[model samples]
Target: MKTEKEKMLAGEAYLATDPQLTADRRQAKKACQLINQGDYDDEAGRNAQLAALINFQGSFYVEPPLYVDYGYNILVGDNFYANHGLTILDGARVVMGKNVFIAPNVVISTAGHPLDKVRRAAGEEFVKPITLGDDVWLGAHVTLCPGVTIGNNVVVGAGSVVVHDLPDNSVCVGTPARPVKSLA
Candidate 1:
């Protein structure tokens, strides 16, 4: 069986050196510059610019200054919009579904270091895939942990630290991200 550390390293290496990754990084940088500078207000222009940052299969939208480490590991769906300072550390795959809205300072991270002292000190890596389903809304400063999945139409409150799976149409808040109510 492949160790978590080994898997993480392999994934990171692939992202850091792959040709597609390099190109995607460049594209992300350029798009960030444009977004931060307040260029590309038109729908067509914005779409064209954002096309390079992620594997966007369906229609989606993003606000400016979007930052990501290893952009190639992210995929997005239709009508997705993320506000300013949206950062993703996609050491593994991160999938966002249709009609997703993310407020400012939101972070979707798929990377983690080891918990053990020796492994942590040596920078042993671990990663897990993150998934956000359709129509999900993440409030400002929300942090999504590795391997967590937010199901369709769920709403995560501001400053929430999501560390577990949130079921579809649920309202989740607080540090550990427990469901407070159901919308379904």
Candidate 2:
């Protein structure tokens, strides 16, 4: 039998309340809380809090008040930067390439409940990986839905919701984010 965590990584339905998964989430949340509430002047202390859950690449900076379902499922390349109020529902893998910039209040979700109320009530949920290529920038209040693979050199405008894949060298905007201009 596959463990809940395994199922989650495999893009299968799983119960979030499973003992092991619950424990993992709790640990991640604790780390997040400590990082958020810790002294702003104590940079080393804050880094220590995220040492276990978040892995740092070459150079990266994420402002406080970050939230994640499972921090282990998120991986970022070099030079990744995120502003305050960032949330990642990383039930599945979330990979951000190098030189990625995310503005405030951005949401990257890989976990979602079933559309069927019965399944939802049963506590069944699914996850899909989200990928952001290098040189991408997500504006404030942008939301990236599950299973999206955004290409490199792409810019997403504020308050946009991305539901599909975006090609490289493009500027996307609006609710269902469409390419408004090509940077190619």
Q: Pick the candidate with the highest lDDT.
A: 2
Clashes of 1: 2
Q: Quantify all predictions' global Cα lDDT against the true fold.
A: 0.80, 0.91
- With a 3 Å backbone cut-off (N, CA, C), the pairs that clash in candidate 1 are 59-78, 59-79
Per-residue lDDT of model 2, residues 7-103, tens digit only: 9889999998899999999988988998899898887777667656776566777789999887998888999888999999999989989999999
lDDT of 1 by residue, 1-184 (tens): 6544345536542224445545655776776676567655576766676676579988676777788866678889887778888999887899988889999999998877767788666655567899999999999999999889999999999999999999998999999988999998
Q: What is the lDDT of residue 177 in candidate 1?
A: 89
User: How many steric clashes between backbone atoms does each model show?
Assistant: 2, 0
Model 2 residue-pair collision total: 0
Model 2 spans with C-alpha error above 4 angstroms? none
Least accurate 10 contiguous residues by lDDT in model 1 = 12-21
Task: State, as a TM-score between 0 and 1, how close model 2 is to the true structure.
Answer: 0.97
**Cα lDDT over the full model 2:** 0.91
